[model samples]
Target: MEELFNLTYKDEVEILKDEDDFEALGDEKYLNHPDMEARLYWAFCRPNGSCEAQIKDIDPLVSIMAFNHSKLNALKRFTLLHKEVIENPNLRVKIKNRTRMLFRSLVDDDFKELNKVLDIVPVFLEVAVDQLKNGRKWNDIFADEIEATIFMQKAEKFIDDSFKEALFFKLKDLRELDQEELKEHLEEIIEKKEKIHTLILKHYKNEVDKWIEKSNLHLLQKMTIKKLAEKLI
Candidate 1:
């Protein structure tokens, strides 16, 4: 179903005031042109461009472009960072058991063309990490936001690290579950990040108790042990 939607979206070439016969032509053109090139063609030539297409419920790329600009930029930056990470022989094999899509692809010595997946990573991460650094809510991060610029409507793990892992397999033309192992590795990374934030939010009763037993929350005197633990967990 999603594939069909993407195909339908790819068909909106030079949006017409009701074109007569060009549906066939556009279909042929799309079929012949590479998927990425065809999508780019629609963006540059369409009326009101990607903006108008989206307004009329046409283009979908605007979702990733219209609002989540930071994520897109981050992915491009990540490519550079990733290139550095891969060049280091010491770091190359470390994430072999990891799950994050981009990281897994970077480590894979045989994988080709890193650019295709770079654009999607940061866009997906924008929401997940938006709350991480800001200490502010979505209303603040996305305040005065333009809907046409955003791709997803709500925040969830669906667009998280696992998707990128799957994409690596697809892009590499290697059919199998090499990425499943990555999940355990990424979970370890997330767990570490959570430990630091636990101090702030004080979630997890047992973990907080363990930290408290170890004098971890001694500085947070104002917070009741239970209240503090809830945030850390």
Candidate 2:
């Protein structure tokens, strides 16, 4: 985590390198391609680039960094993207896609760590709702249709994992209570669980059109609550 705090933009390329053969862990290999900066620029700037082209160009490095390095490193990248968007609000759509890549690469444990470090869901929701209310089109929410779909899928997984983790911890706590305490807390426990379920269901993407119109904007914000610190700034 300390290392993440000290990471400057100048070192981003080095950190993204496939040093130590970390990319060979999975079935697919992520070769450390050269001219990474140029690829990144094109990925984010090309007006007519294919969604596959944009994601494929950088996902290998983002994946290795998120899964192999540390969750904090992912947060760092996400925050940096947020800063980029802040500096150039026009890049919001493009940068959002890249940040969601980091979000998708993270596991349940990484999400937990992110929540601990920074609760970013509310901030994202606020921004989303504000933008929609200001007339930002649904199609403009992400870089493209494919990215929107992928991001929503990852959001659903995050919601499911969060609900299960909450339930497990709640049950564990209940087990430690005395019989009398358990009896007294039964209603409270049920209420808490129901609340979690309700929150999860609220973002369950019943329909994209319906979700976008929902005033609360509690959409995919829950997926990377930790990494969204600068996302909407």
Per-model TM-score on C-alpha atoms:
0.22, 0.25
lDDT of each model, Cα atoms only? 0.33, 0.34
lDDT of 2 by residue, 144-223 (tens): 22222233333453434543343232222322444345334433333444333333222222222332344343546423
Tell me each candidate's RMSD, in Å, in order: 18.8, 19.1
Q: Which stretches of candidate 2 lie over 4 Å from their true place?
A: 1-72, 86-88, 105-107, 116-233
Candidate 1 positional error at 227, Å: 13
Best by lDDT: 2
Stretches > 4 Å off in candidate 1: 1-17, 20-25, 34-39, 43-131, 135-233
lDDT (Cα) of model 1? 0.33
lDDT per residue (tens digit) for residues 6-113 in model 1: 445434443432577554545444423455556445434443323322212222332222212222322343332333233454543442222143333332322122
